[model samples]
Target: MQPHVTTALQAWIASWTAHERAAQDVMEAAFPGLKPTPAPTGCCDVQMRWERDGEGSGTACLDDHGRATIQFEDVPKAAVGHAMTEVFGNGWFNEGPDGFAGAPPGKYCWEDDCTYAECEIDIGDDGLAAVAISYVKIEDVVAILDALETGLEAVRPSA
Candidate 1:
C-alpha cells in the first residue's frame, strides 16, 4: 500500500475507534445498568492486504470484528458500473441515478440477511475512476477478514 493510503486508513480506523468509545461513554453515563462490552486487545488493529489483477489493484482492510473495505484503485468508470452490477445483480444496476445529460453520479446500497453494503460512483470528465466493496455485520465481517488474512498470508507477507 502507498504511504498516504495507509495513513488515511489508519486515520479512518482511529476515527471509528474514538467514535465507538465516545458512544459507549455516553451510553454508560445515561444508563447505569448498561454493561460495557470489552473489546479484545488490539481489536482495532486491522490487517490490510493488497492484491493486483488485470483490472486494478485493491486494498482489503479488515478489522478483527470482520468489517472490511476492499478498495479498488484506478478502476475505470465503466468497470465500476460493472462491478456494482455484479454485487447487486443484473437488474439492480441503473436503479440509482439515471446518469442523464445533467444528472450527477449516484450512490446505492444493497443489503441481505447478514450484511449491508454500498457503492458510490463519480463519473465526469476529470478522468478519475474508482470502486469499492464493503462488508458489514460483525460476524460476517470477521469471518471474511479471517479467511482473506489466512489466504493472503499463505501467499505474501501482510503489512
Candidate 2:
C-alpha cells in the first residue's frame, strides 16, 4: 500500500482502538469482574466476558459507532419482560388477548431519519437476551451500562 494509504489505515485502526478502550474502561469500572474476550477476527468491535458467581454469564461488545450490545445467557424467562421494560420503558411490549405481544426483535431507530440513536433487543428460545443500545455521545455509554446492569439485576436472583 502507498504511504498515504497506510497512514490513513493506521489512523482508522487507532480510532477504533481508542473507542474500544474507552468503552472497556467504563465497563471494567462498573463490573470489576469483567474480563477481556477475543473479538471476532477482522471485526471492529471490542468484546468482554463477565460472570456473576452462581448467577450467570454474559458478553458485551462495543462497536466502532459506540453502540454497545450486551447478551445475557440463561436468563430467567420470567425476568425477560421486566428487563425489556427496564431498558425500553413501559408499553414497549404490546398487549394481546393471549398475552403480551413483543415488538419485532431487530434494530430500529427512535427517529424516522435515524439521525438519533438506534436500539434493538432479541430474545432467543434458550433464554438468551441480546440488547443493543446506541449512543450519540460518549458520555451516554454510562447510561447504557446502567440500563444493562438494571436489566441484569432483574434477571438474577437476589443475594
- Best-matching candidate per TM-score: 2
lDDT of each: 0.44, 0.56
Task: Report the lDDT tens digits of candidate 1 across residue range 1-159.
Answer: 999999999999888888555544433333222334333323334433334443345444444544555555544444454434433444443544532112244443344444566544445454334445565543333343343333323443345
How far residue 13's Cα lies from its native spot in candidate 2, in Å, is 1.9
Q: Judged by lDDT against the true structure, how good is candidate 1?
A: 0.44
Tens-place lDDT per residue, model 2, 53-151, is 533577666766676655555444335445445445655334222211243333323421454655554555554545444543445545555554665
Q: State, as a TM-score between 0 and 1, how close model 2 is to the true structure.
A: 0.54
C-alpha lDDT (0 to 100) for residue 89 of candidate 2:
62
Residue pairs in steric clash, candidate 1? 66-141, 66-142
The runs of at least 3 residues in candidate 1 whose Cα sits more than 4 Å from the true structure, single-residue gaps closed, are 1-46, 49-58, 90-114, 124-128, 137-159
In terms of lDDT, the poorest run of 10 residues in model 1 is 26-35
